[model samples]
Target: MNIKITGTGSYIPNEIQKNEDFNNHQFFNENGSKIEYSNDVIINKFKKITGIEERRYASAQQNTSDLAFLSAQKAIDNANIDPETLDYIIVAHNFGDVDMNTSQADTVPSLAARVKHKLKIENPYCVAYDLLFGCPGWIEGVIHAQSFIKSNMAKRCLVIGAETLSRVVDKHDRDSMIYSDGAGASIIETTKDTGGIISTISASYTLDESNFLFFGKTYNKASNDEKKYIKMHGRKIYEFALNYVPKAMKACLDRTRFDISDVKKILIHQANEKMDEAIVNRFYGLYNEEVPEGIMPMSIQKLGNSSVATIPTLYDLILKQKIDNHQIHKGDILLFASVGAGMNINAFLYQF
Candidate 1:
């Protein structure tokens, strides 16, 4: 039996946070020194590098799990499957459900359990849990689902990538501008179909790169309040991704014994536009070929980096014909890849 993604869905929050919104805000360096550049200058440079002009933010009433449930429901409806038949519910996220009023993350009940409860799937046999594998969490969840189906442990599974980065960001840090909130989900199951997952690869560089992305105090050193928010060494991550992501992608593709020209579209994590372009270029460089036009579809220009949600969300949008000039058809070969916080990297080859 082939493991396949039967249906997909995404939930992009309604509130839009524009770059101009940061004009009046104070920005600081990691060392607590005030940024010398004007807000306009900084924002312009940010736009050029990350390709993000605006991003979505969840409303006060919505948490990460709520967003996950909304997306999961849509996926179920899209697949036209009975919720009670699901054998597993896997939710991937870095921070748990973070309230709008507090910085604390709540995971007393796993996000998957919460989603299962919300979906009202009463089957006790439906195992539910959460996975935290950085931005690649969603893809990792899919890998796990595939393993379960192949091992005869499960027949149907729901995997979701959801995050409320806005609630976990340090407003004083400029990097916070790179983050947004959203969720994406998919229904994966055994199928007799022709195309599905082809090959997958995953790796972690924890020795020196462990702290490339981590939680730290605000950039404002004067503030005595002890609170930690998501932080990262942007330069370090950029270098790490460029050096390793391409190799991982090529390795995954090599395993499938497929030529590089066979890939139709690459759905990479929308972390940084420049970084992603570099990774793709390098991947092609490995084969001594020029990068093809439209080989990749990007949502970062409008979505920012929603961590685990980027790839699946992009997939949902393209499948629904929401992205202009980009479409996926049967027999098309697609490459999905991501690099994020754990200093982690992963890629999967899929045939649609």
Candidate 2:
């Protein structure tokens, strides 16, 4: 069964946080005590480590579901598909707008119900929900939608990746510098269409259990969990990317029976530049230097880390910025891979 994406869309918060913003605030609290730290210290540390100068963040009023809804609506309209006909809707990521509901509860049902009210398809097979291993959730969602459509279980499915990292960010901690907020959407159908999800490959390293890098949310909300900040094991993730990326790339290439040279572009997981450079250097040693010229790494030195949204966000940016100059022809191979919070990793070779 061939699954294809009919349309794509994305959304970021309206608010932008600059380096100076951090310079003005302290990221932690002493729980009825006192502390000495400001955003300036964190900002400088972020520059030294990730090289990011600014990032966008959702406001207290906004949530992940809002971003998902915005992007999903655009993708649905762009596809020219009626929401009433949609058989499934997949919500990825760990955040949402509604505070009391599950991510999907706050997300899928609300979006689908809105569509029903607007598009008139009050019922479409079923409104199923579950979590993907994340990092890999969007691809997994596309594949799942394809299976459903092919099986006659549904006709259309919308997959979303949304995160309010800022909501969970421990501003007092330097590790929080690695996360931001955003969302993305993709419309998938069970057809041999010109654009959509293609083959996907996932692999992991069990030996490096310590490479979890960092935990996303703490039960105590950072103030109690090591100063309420995101603590990242940078060197560990960096090393893991260097050692695992090449092997993972080879595995995907092998699965598709395509050589590395056959790939036109590689949309790598937005690892920081240092990690990218080191991994690419190691990639050359393991294989040839044919990883393509414009390897899309979304860590643009200032966007911070957007978790799941980074991959598709980069794809959208590339589409908008370079499509006129470098037209994406039929069957152009677009390779994508991402390594996220749980030590999860995935590679999807998309044919546009």
Candidate 3:
């Protein structure tokens, strides 16, 4: 069975938090107390590195499932498919519906199950489940759905990546500036069409677990309680992305027997602008060519790093012509890549 993405949708919270918002805030240590850092100094460093000017934060009452529902509904509508017709609903998220302020994680029925309920899909055959694959969760979920289609187990699948990172980020930490909340979704179905997912590759480097990113219980001054928050060694991740992501992309292209010059657009995870640019540049460099300026598009400037939701959201924007000069035509070849928390990296070659 051949798989094609029929439609895509995304939702960003209405609330906006600018980089300057962190200027005067005290940086937090492991004990959850504040260290001193001027907001201007930190903000400038963030701008130079991530190109993030601001990020969205979900409302206090909104949960990850809620965001997923919004994005999924738009995708379903765009696909013109009935909710009950979906064979699978895979929701990708690291932390479940965590409290926006408390940073408490909760996944009682699975985010996919909650999304199914909210969509009012009563079909017992419409299996729903949650996937946790670090920040590449959504991409991995898409790869999984393709397997089901290849085995003739499913006809239509809804893959949604939703996260309320604000709840999982310690505002007192500089990393919080890079984390944000949003949802993105896509409808993938078996199609006779020629342009879809052509080739893909995914792998992880986890020989020493301590080297990769992980969540640790930290002090949250806001809630005055110990909470699990995301923490990572910045240098390690930066080096890993620079070294391996380009290799991954080249491998995928080689497997697809497609030339990098033929790719029209590159939609990468909105993790960090500088890192993404470097990854694409290195990939093109392997062919001894200069990286084309417009071939790669970015949303990290405004969206920050939304983990799994980044790629789909960026894809949706491109599909809707929201990004300048970034339009997708039928038969246009595109590249999607991401590397994050799992110390994982993946790339997919797709034609639309």
Candidate 4:
């Protein structure tokens, strides 16, 4: 038996936050000093590096779990499967249900439990839970599903990646522009089909890279509030990803004994466009081959980085023909890779 993704779905928010919207806002450095550059200069430099001119934000009424539920519902419908038959409901996210007005994350009944409740899966045996593996959480959730199915613990599983980063962002920091909100989900199950998951690789670098991304106070040092917000060492993350992500992808592809040319598409986390391009270039260089044109599809240009939701969202969009010039066909080899907080990295090879 092989494990395969039977259905995919995603919920792109309706609210659009453009870069020009931040022009009036004040941005500050982490050192408590005001940024010297004009807003246009800062945003222009940001676009040049990250390729994000706009991003989606969840409406005030929506929480992380709500986004997960919406995406999960679409996946279930797309699969045309009964919710009761699902053996597992795994929700992957960093921040839980963050309210619109506060930074406190509500994870009391786990996001998975909340999603299962929202899905109304009355079967108590469905075993709903949540996974927090940083931006790679969704991929990690799928990996866990594969493990459970292979171990006879589950037959059909629903993996969802969702986040409300806009709610947790520090408005005073320029890095806040990199965050948005969205969710994506997929139904994975055992199948008699020929192509499925071929190989997977995962690693965590915590000795010195642990705090590359973390929760910290806002950049405005004048604020005496004790509330913390999402923060990261952007340069550190870029350098770390460049050094490690390519090797992880190559290692995953190598395990399948497939040539680099066989990879039809790469769905990487939409962290930064230039960084992703460099990583893919180095990945191809490992095999002494030039990067193929259009081999990687991106949603970051409009979606920004929705943390764990990035890869799955990109995959869902491509599969649904929502992303132009990118399509997935049967017998095509695909690589999925991600790197994020926890200083974690993971990659998996899948054949469609």
Worst 10 residues of 4 by lDDT: 218-227
Q: After superposition, how far is residue 130 of candidate 4 from its true place, in Å?
A: 0.7
Question: What's each prediction's TM-score?
Answer: 0.99, 0.80, 0.95, 0.99
Report the C-alpha lDDT of model 1 over 1-352, residue by residue, as the tens digit. Answer: 6889999999999999999999988999989999999999999999999999999999999999999999999999999999999999999999999999577989989999999999998999999999999999999999999999989999999999999999989888999999999999999999999989999999999999999999999999988858889999999899999999999999999998789999999999999999999999999999999999999999999999999999999999999999999999999999999999888999999999
The residue pairs in collision within model 3 are 23-39, 331-352
| Candidate 2: Cα lDDT at 302 | 53
What range of 10 consecutive residues in model 3 has the weakest lDDT sum? Answer: 217-226
Please report how far candidate 4 places residue 173 from its true position, in Å: 0.5
lDDT of each: 0.95, 0.63, 0.87, 0.95
Candidate 4 lDDT score at position 266: 95
Q: Cα deviation in Å at residue 125, candidate 3?
A: 0.6
- Cα RMSDs, all models: 0.7, 4.7, 2.0, 0.7
lDDT of 3 by residue, 172-224 (tens): 67888999899999999998878789988999888854356877755455665
- State in Å the error of residue 330, model 1: 0.5
Question: Could you tell me the TM-score of candidate 4?
Answer: 0.99
